[model samples]
Target: MTLLPDPIISTWLFSSVVFGPWSNHVTGWWEKKQTHSKLLYLFYEDMVEVNQITTSCAIKMLLELEYSIQVRGRVQFENMKKNSFVNYFTSLAMDFKISPFMRKGKVGDWKNHFTVAQSEQFDEDYKKKMKNITVQFHTVV
Candidate 1:
């Protein structure tokens, strides 16, 4: 069985925590749709899409934008793509029988799991909840 038995519940909770008010406050930019000099909003999909060959360049640019610091060398970037960090973390999670931090790591994986009715319900609920929110997600479904 998948670690996340209920994708809806898990997705809701993850979204609520990651994109919720708390995260916005921490970043100090989400509430205000306009870009802040001090805050750099970096979406994982955006970064990956910007350069599919290597996310290092995108990540470096984001860091520079956020901290105004120069990130030197390709070593760190190569390491980031190696999956060593993810493997280590996932191994720990496995030892504890906890949900894996990294699942399929593929975009639009929900299409494989969510039923038609469930997808419709989620979409309706999402639209209603996000109607007043400025942040938008580029979802596949």
Candidate 2:
């Protein structure tokens, strides 16, 4: 979850937000998109297509934000896939008994999780929610 530095202080929930959202919890990156034109939204599944390049882009983004050398080095995409993300988030979910933050982290895991009906529902909801947005989903899977 990340928050914008506004007087209203809109908070956006990433998928990793364990408990989901609250009453006034801001949803999506809409605010971020509007406020920070340079923001890049990355999906984990898309990273499967070009892990190295996407990781480099992420590192470059963090570098632009002046991340400390240690933090930057630790955030390498391979490390995120193996140690930093899966193990750490699995431990978090185990500690809490909720769905793990690292839910497979694989492209097409949705096919296993979502039934046809569920997938249709998601598609409809996504279409409605993202009506005017120009986001792209990878098709290489």
Candidate 3:
């Protein structure tokens, strides 16, 4: 992974590619979720369509952000996708055309891109780094 200057999606998916280990970000919120009512800890795979709607509504309500029906329906997700401020795909740092920001967001999609060696390396690294992390995440749904 060090041979390449920029990490591919595989390494980024594993964690700590660009910034600090993603585990650090997640672990920071670990104990907070237990004490905080507003903290919505979630796994993408566990969120079905209904859960997604409820979660989105809960987030908006918690943040006290109001959105009109028409405004919400009009912009949709495309609004964020097009807005350079919110979309890193528009950034010059890395080319999104190569990996694409919104790839198929299905469970176990990592298997499609990762090889056996890469998977082994990631697993070993995960064990070492996540030794104290209490969050339980599964790669496949």
Candidate 4:
């Protein structure tokens, strides 16, 4: 599950891809229903981090949960470690100019996009909506 960015930067993309079809309400409901074991939530910033370790861990969990595959010692595991699919897919996305998907894939990019008022409003709304949700996001990229 992809996480929404902090309200500061999220306002710019809130109505776009960031929260395009899903909201915290929907995600919270799903998280409650599935519980942590069945549902793995991943943050985009973490996934695109400098080392990509978080992304690798998410991929490993997906393989284990969805396919019931033990990632260690598997061909799929080795390929993922080498980021074969991720590299290829990123290249394709770059070729297509999918800016939202590829642009400045980093943490704290919201600092570059959001105004103070917008950020405060988003924070208020986020706190109200996500108050009961137990899942927390990583603040660092």
Greater-TM-score candidate between 2 and 4:
2
Candidate 4 clashes: the total is 1
| Per-residue lDDT of candidate 3, residues 1-141 (tens digit) | 123222563566465654446666767888788789778776656543344465566557554445434434433445545555554644466676675554455677777666667777678867887788778878765
Specify the highest-lDDT model's number. Answer: 3
The residue pairs found clashing in candidate 3 are: none
Per-model RMSD to reference: 6.8, 10.1, 5.5, 8.2
> What residue runs in model 2 are displaced by over 4 Å at the alpha carbon?
1-27, 64-98
Query: What's the TM-score of every candidate structure?
Result: 0.49, 0.56, 0.58, 0.49
TM-score, ranked from best to worst: 3, 2, 4, 1
Judged by lDDT relative to the true structure, which candidate is superior, 1 or 4? 4
Worst 10 residues of 3 by lDDT: 1-10
Candidate 2: global Cα-lDDT?
0.52
Residue-level lDDT tens digits of model 2 in 1-141: 122232221221214344443211223565566678567677766566766676667767756545545554554555554564444633343562344445444576556645566556556655665566666655335
| 1-141 per-residue lDDT for model 1 (tens digits) | 232346644465346543343333533456553655544555545544554433444545456544322333322334444545543543331452344434554567766766666667667766765676667676542
Q: Which parts of model 4 are misplaced by more than 4 Å?
A: 1-38, 48-56, 64-99
Go through the candidates in order and give each one's C-alpha lDDT. Answer: 0.49, 0.52, 0.61, 0.52
Model 4: per-residue Cα lDDT over 84-112, one tens digit each? 34434443424533343334444776656
